[model samples]
Target: MVFEPDRLPVPAPVIMIVEPYGGSIRQQNPNLPMVFWDDAALTRGDGIFETLLIREGRICNLERHGARFKASAALLGLPEPILADWEKATHMALEAWFSHPHAGEASCTWTLSRGRASTGLASGWLVVQPISAEKIRQREQGVSVMTSSRGYTVEDYLPGIDVATGEAKGKIPKNPAPWMTVGAKTLAYAANMAALRYANANGFDDVIFTDGERVLEGATSTVVSFKGDKLRTPTPGGDILPGTTQAALFEYASAKGWRCKARELSLDHLYGADSVWLVSSVRIATRVTKLDGQKLPKPNNEKEIRALINKALG
Candidate 1:
């Protein structure tokens, strides 16, 4: 069976196209043709994007998303996004989306791509849609995850690092390779989506990618495990995209006197943790109830953990 993501019961999403040259925002019909066939974003996936949560007319965690957006652009060698312009487009899309009869949380994704080779200008746009019930359900009820090998080792990113022992062979190189696109949230997500499909085909809600020896991250979310008073996530660098939600949670948890750290995580850590969660911008926090068909132990203080995650999410 194919895994299909849940969709909102809407006719069409609100689309705000950002002009390639002057940075002007224009509303377009979702059913209409807007992007050109020759656009590199379509042809080569030569672009980057960020998905942000919109609650009560406000975009949650804009600063973190913006930082990651810029970082992805820098990694992809794309032009820096104009924050003011994107902010304006976000509001415009939100206004358009809310003008409809929709309710509940929504999301806005900003996409920037290299323009047609003939034109040399860039293309940018924003898409606003309501968050689906499936995501809400997963956030509330938790998920059953399957682990899949990412085929490459973390050592590819953090050179000389041992996946099993979590030991560095030597000082990691300052730069690995530009083509790696390790941390950038680029449009080239076919592999990631394929991983999700494989997991779904195997009767799993989501996938946690591992390098055959050590865990990496979720397909689209971050892998975070709580043991004792400490909150630990996979160390972010070339192996995976740095998680904005995880970073925010760590900051809030740290202020609340919870120990937070990033390190090379193993499957044993999750299987042995008090509780495991998959965190992302839209989903916020979703507990992992099972891994690879084995039931995980319940969290000792699930209620308190949920409360803290809700507070941190807000």
Candidate 2:
């Protein structure tokens, strides 16, 4: 299930400009110029964004995304977003998106940025577009992945720790380094894009980032592995962004008698698991068919797993 770059989604997108404060949500031409040239979103990539799935006619996991959006804004010292305004803007974009001649599975993004350097205001927008057929293909056929180094260890997240004593005298602080921006979904995605390009260049569909030993996460998704009846993922509050889709999966799977755990994981954990998957809001779940060019063991209950994933997403 190798996917080519051209197989990516090409649906016409609809955009809506939103006011960070209490202002009107107006529809805008996505192809036309909207933001100013000096906006931090364009010049310095200083902003936060979240992409969510649109199933049927409504947005999926809106509250979770809203919480994350606010958290990211706080991390960047930006003003808190009004989720109601964003909701209205998303509905506007969705209305425009469904008006298209051919509409498929759709998704929307909430983009909030620090406005122009002069005014010192904030700019926000909502974009709704159809999800790619390639994503559907990957969901059904699985994906091949390669691992990349994140260049920092999880220990780095613990600030003020004495390396000599291998411990901290007080309560161990987690992700204390604000500049690292570990959990925030900011707009500075050059490195993530570069990792994806590198993976595609190397003949893989996606990339999983590791801290040389512990598995951090997928480039754009969360990594989940199942062994027996236990489902496990890497612990968040470190360098990994907590996944909304994965959280939904855990909630539903737990009720179905599946044990879910978040702990430090390694590549060996994935390799030794009965099955591995990459989960996200748009893609739902994509199984790992191959890891670093080696074929992985297939899950015995693949059909059941897919059914569970669909139910969880719903």
Candidate 3:
């Protein structure tokens, strides 16, 4: 089918914001009411969101995602969300999306904003119907990646200096103001989209970001890989948002007898790894075929890693 960004339905999801005083639910979209968010998230990027993959109408690894979302919100000083209510909202959103005729196999996003201007915490939801099954299919063939140099990394967590913008690739000009939500999955994603556009312009599928000279993550996914029996990823110690998929993979790798470590990684380590994969809810595990202009040797253990992920998801 032709890829139409607007027609895509929201994947099954919901969001809520809970503060010390009270909480509110944001389920008002007719098609995917539970997936709606307020303008604060859109305009000011003052919110956090979770993108989840629904298989057979079931949210995968939801608890992990929720916990991480809460952590990110706390980092940004947003009100903590009610996890139980959010989970119910997610189910409601998913049911609405799946019931729609146009809804195909797809992914969905759940966003929580701080209230409105008067309150300081507001949340919203959006469910994009599925489009471009081909795009999902292409992930299996691996992807080409480009790198960006515009972002920063925080090696150690200090008060008030938590925000880090890792890279910007395309039309979205770098913001002169320091955005507080850079490390959170806030709605201000123009920077991430710009990186994606940069990758597309360069004939690649995505962009991996770096802080200074250390590898961070992709515009939309977390980077991980196996180097001879060792599985490694960039530690969340820096500005990188800790990813749910990355956490799950670590568990799976450990159960499968692989040594897992989280540390700082440089571009040199990424280019020389036996296999480099990007992890997220929808894409799951997509191998990186090339970086910059260098083609990497296909990992001899691709099948094993895939199996590990499949088992974890199950």
Candidate 4:
């Protein structure tokens, strides 16, 4: 395994603020500083979270992330997080980030988890920190992706349906599995992190997961592709997490004369695409210049894409 200390900065004295049980807000110095032997979020990963970009003073796509956060919480059987709670906590985190020595481009993460329900408390916290320059460089220079199997097919999440989009008809499947927790951005991300680590250990920058024969998503980002004036991503009906950045990019690109679609994708399709990308809130859209050690067909246009996305994203 490669240890790239420069690439991943070890956080020092993590500054964070919290609003426990949706009550009065409080701040914590250096790390969470909480004793949670019974916390479901930590032990069982029974929680929901959202990582959002704080551009200037605005939470990029607050409404979109808020909706997803609430939905995920509800699916996980945790207390729903209201938008106001997140907004209040986010501003507090921004305050902490600005005071930090390494602050620049900022990212905020809000986590709402199942706490001691008998005590009528649910654990929630919002922490803001610097967006790493190495992460930005991945977007600036592009990243390589390696495909990994999800073990579960798309049917485990969204059964019997193919294409989906935020604007598509019947986007959410009928009778989705409650235990599946598909499309919900929950704190149960160990598998996702493991996939990324596996890719990193093998020399790839990131991972693209596949369900059965179809490509699903990047470990922490949405897999996006462009072919013949079409911007395409795997449909949420395929149980892929609906990416806020990917959807926003599609909308932004649409205004710029690019047609966008959310549909079923296969590895073969990506291999034949003109260009590919892995998009997330902080990373925006990072070009996939190489996949599985083989250079992809398209020449990288990250500069042009980044400028357009940055303008649109900001």
Error of 1 at 274 (Å): 0.7
Q: What tens-digit string does per-residue lDDT give for candidate 4 at 1-314? A: 89874565434433344554456776677544663677777777777889898887678978888877877766567776767866886777677666654455678888887775455467877777667877879977898888889756555335222222333334456766635545677787888898888889999999898876689888899988877677888876445778888878888888998888888899999999988889899888788889888898654554666676676676
What lDDT tens digits, residue by residue, belong to model 1 across residues 1-314? Answer: 67554543563688999864554688999889998989999999999899998876788889989888877777677888888788888888887787776444788899999988888888999898877788999988999999988865544444312321234444557775435545678898898899888888889999999886578889999999999999999887656667888888999999999999998999888888999999999988899999999999887799888888767767
lDDT of 2 by residue, 29-129 (tens): 77799989999999999999999999887788788888889877876778899888898888878877877756656889899999899999999988888
RMSDs, each prediction? 5.0, 5.1, 6.8, 4.6
TM-score each candidate: 0.89, 0.89, 0.78, 0.85
Summing lDDT over every window of 10 consecutive residues in candidate 1, give the lowest-scoring window: 157-166
TM-score of 1: 0.89
* lDDT (Cα, 0-100) at 298 in candidate 4: 59
lDDT of 3 by residue, 1-314 (tens): 78886555545333232222344544553443332244466557667778877776677888888877776777677767767766766676667676765555566676667645654545445453463465576568888888887464443334323332233312333553434334566666788898888789879988888876788888888999779989899876435767788888898778879899988899999877899998888888888888987898797777877888766765
Clashing pairs in 1: 160-169
How well does candidate 2 score on lDDT at residue 28? 87
RMSD of 2: 5.1
Q: State the C-alpha lDDT per candidate.
A: 0.82, 0.84, 0.69, 0.74
Q: After superposition, how far is residue 259 of candidate 1 from its true place, in Å?
A: 0.6
Better of 1 and 2 by lDDT: 2
Off by over 4 Å in 2: 1-11, 153-180
